[model samples]
Each structure stands twice: as C-alpha cells, then as structure tokens.
Target: MKRLWGTECAPAWRAWLDRATEQIFRHPDCGAVERELLDHLEDKATDLMRIFPGLTREEAEQRALEEMGAAEELGEELARVHSPLVGELWQLTRFLIRAVLVVLAVECLWLLWKFA
Candidate 1:
C-alpha cells in the first residue's frame, strides 16, 4: 500500500501537496483547490506536530499520510475537479469567447423584447 503511493509515504504527502500546489500554477484562479491543499497541509502538519515530539519534515509527512489519506486518493479527488488546460490556452480562450457570445446574444434578445 505504501509502495502504491510514491518514493515514500514520508515524502509522498509533501509531493502530493506540491502537485496540488502546482495546480495553482496551472489555474491561479482555483480558490477551491488552493483552500483544500492549504487545509490539508495544516491538518497534517498539526497531526504530525501532535504525534511526534520535534518531528522533522519526513516525520511530519509520514504522520500526515496516516491522517490525511493517500496520495492516490488526493490525486483522484483533485482529478475530479482539475480542468487542467495545460498548454491548451487556445481551447480555453475559445470556450470563453463562445460563452461571452452566448451571453451577448441573450442580452440582445432581452433588449429587443423589452423595446417591442
């Protein structure tokens, strides 16, 4: 089960948090992901802080794994909401343009109906 995680559960939690943090790099506007990651880090850090006295980073991360769930689980949860556009900015831009067009069309229709 631990091998199913990563290098080690100790490093794995940090790596998972880093990966989640990287999601912010991809979508800086994702408040939800950022909040979740921060909360997860804080909770795990506190748990580690409580369990082992003077815990190092490794010890903290390991304790985090026990309380915070697996990296795979975190990844899966993020994947559910991660609309990672990556280098597909063009597609995202196009989608935005289409959405704006629809809104404009709706507004135009509303104005015409009101005037008539």
Candidate 2:
C-alpha cells in the first residue's frame, strides 16, 4: 500500500498491515484503519530516524513495527472494536424497516384503489 508520506511501503510493511487488518469486518473500515495504522508507523519510523541518525529508513521502520507489537494481537483487538455482529444487526434492522415500509405502501395503494 502507498503511504501517506507519498512513498510506496515495503513489502514487509504491506504484509504487516494486511495481517493487522485482516480480521476487520468491513472492507472500507479496514482501509481506514489500515491508513491510520500506516500513519502511526510512519510517525514512529520518522521519530526513530530522528533519534538515531545512523539508522536506515528500513531499519527505523522495522523497529517501529517491533515496538507496535504482534500484528495478530493487534488484529484481534481491531476485530473486536469493529465487531461484525453490530454491522450484521444494523443490516438486519434496515432490512426489516424497509420491509415494513414496503408493506405499508402496498396497503395504502390497496386502500386508495378500493375506496376510489
């Protein structure tokens, strides 16, 4: 993925972001979360580089990822935060509401026809 810093991310960074957001339910939400994570990674890497001028960009990025901890664990936490159950429930509620509205519209049409 391309970084907000206007540079293409390394394959390792891409892989990490993938693993980190794989568990998120919604694809759009996953993208947003990934961007946020990438921003944090970039900030951390920049800070690291500033702190240690001897560190290469890749080295700083690697250290930033390490400091962020395990991707799997972060993924699980993100998954919980972006719960599929809530999204599913909202979808169901919308479907039910639309169904009810359709039923009422049909009934209104029927009444208008009968009373005409």
Candidate 3:
C-alpha cells in the first residue's frame, strides 16, 4: 500500500492496526478470536525484523512489497465484506480481459476461430 498510497503514511497505518485490534476485540464471532491471535503473531514478527535495522535499502523495498501484497489481500477480504458487487465486477473485468487477449492471440495465428 505504501507504493500505491505513500511511504510517509506508516504512522497512519499504525493507527489502523490499533483500530483493527479494537474491532476484533469487539467482534462476537469465535473465528475473530483466532484472527486476533494471528494478528498478534504477525505484528510481533514485523516488529522483530523492524527493530534490527541492518537490512539494505533493496532488501527493505522487497520486504515492503511483500507486506503490501499481504495488505492488498486483506483489503480484498474487507472489500468483500462491505461491497461484494465491486469485487464481482473486478472479477468479471479480469475474466473479460483474459478472454479478449486469448481471442486476439487466436486471430493473430489464423485470422479465424479454428476451434469453433
């Protein structure tokens, strides 16, 4: 998210973590308790690596990218909960894009639909 958002917003991100923990604590579901445990482990690992600041800049960028990928997955899960239609639309768009690419490739090979 830092790449899509901004690197300087890490403090804001920290605040988000606090809010999420509070939400989990308030949740009535049993699975949320497990999520809280997992969140605690993840935060500990992140803080562990963060405290030993000897990694190179390149390594740091790679770590940030990995973290962002995980965050994007989390964002998708949250989006699924709030706006499932948006998620469905994004899925449909991706499917159509792949179909178009496949159609163009077939046209390039023979200028026709050989299979059909």
Candidate 4:
C-alpha cells in the first residue's frame, strides 16, 4: 500500500474509492476499477507532494480525494458510463443464472453417485 510514497495511504484511499465506485461496477470490474482508482489516488498524492513541498502524505491524499469530487456524483457518472441499467435486475439475472448452473451440477453429481 505504501510502496510508493512510504506512507500508508491505501487504507484511506481505498475506503473512499470503495464508497465511490462500489455501486457502479460488478464483481471483477469493481475490483479492477478500485485498483485503477487507488493507483490514481496514489499518483495524485505523490504529485501533490512534489508540487508543494511541506504537504504531508495524508494532506496530499485528502486534497486528492476532495479534488476527485463527491462520491455520489462520481459513482453516478461511472454507473452511467459502465452500466446504464444499474439495478437489482442485473443482480437478479446473474444470481439466477449461477443458481441454475449450480443446481444442474449438483443434480449431475447426485446422479453419478447414485449410479456408481
């Protein structure tokens, strides 16, 4: 987490990023987006410190998060671009599909066990 600036900035940065981008993406995409945003935040914090000497790491990260805008606004914008139809329907669809596949696999395994 602090591999770049020698500061534990990841916890703060990730907390904010998760609150910001959590609802915009699905499982894998959400992890990717979080990593990307964390990298950006770390880079921004480094840049801020470079630009203004005397700025602490925490100060730089806070400024960067503020500059990134409110979480709700960013989340909504990302949701619009990534999933225009971000709702329970998508969640339900994925859940149902997985559930059916799991049930089928279980049934197949049961049949095999019974036959054997």
Give per-model TM-scores.
Answer: 0.40, 0.69, 0.33, 0.60
- Sort the candidates on TM-score, descending order: 2, 4, 1, 3
Query: Which stretches of model 1 miss by more than 4 angstroms?
Result: 1-14, 18-26, 29-35, 51-54, 82-116
The weakest ten consecutive residues by lDDT in model 4 span: 1-10
- The whole-model lDDT of each prediction reads 0.60, 0.86, 0.47, 0.73
lDDT of 4 at 11: 71
- Among these predictions, the greatest TM-score belongs to 2
What's the CA RMSD for each of the models?
8.6, 5.8, 13.5, 7.8
Which structure among the candidates has the greatest lDDT?
A: 2
Candidate 1 to truth, TM:
0.40
Could you give candidate 2's per-residue lDDT for residues 15-90 as a string of tens digits? 8988898898676567788889989999999999999999999999899999999999999999998887877887
Model 1: per-residue lDDT, tens digit, 13-106? 5466655444333444344554566567667777778877789876676666566666556656666556566436757888999999999999
Which residue runs of candidate 2 sit more than 4 Å off their true CA positions?
1-7, 88-116
Error of 2 at 25 (Å): 1.9
Of the candidates numbered 2 and 4, which has the greater TM-score value? 2
Q: Can you give the lDDT of residue 100 in candidate 1?
A: 100
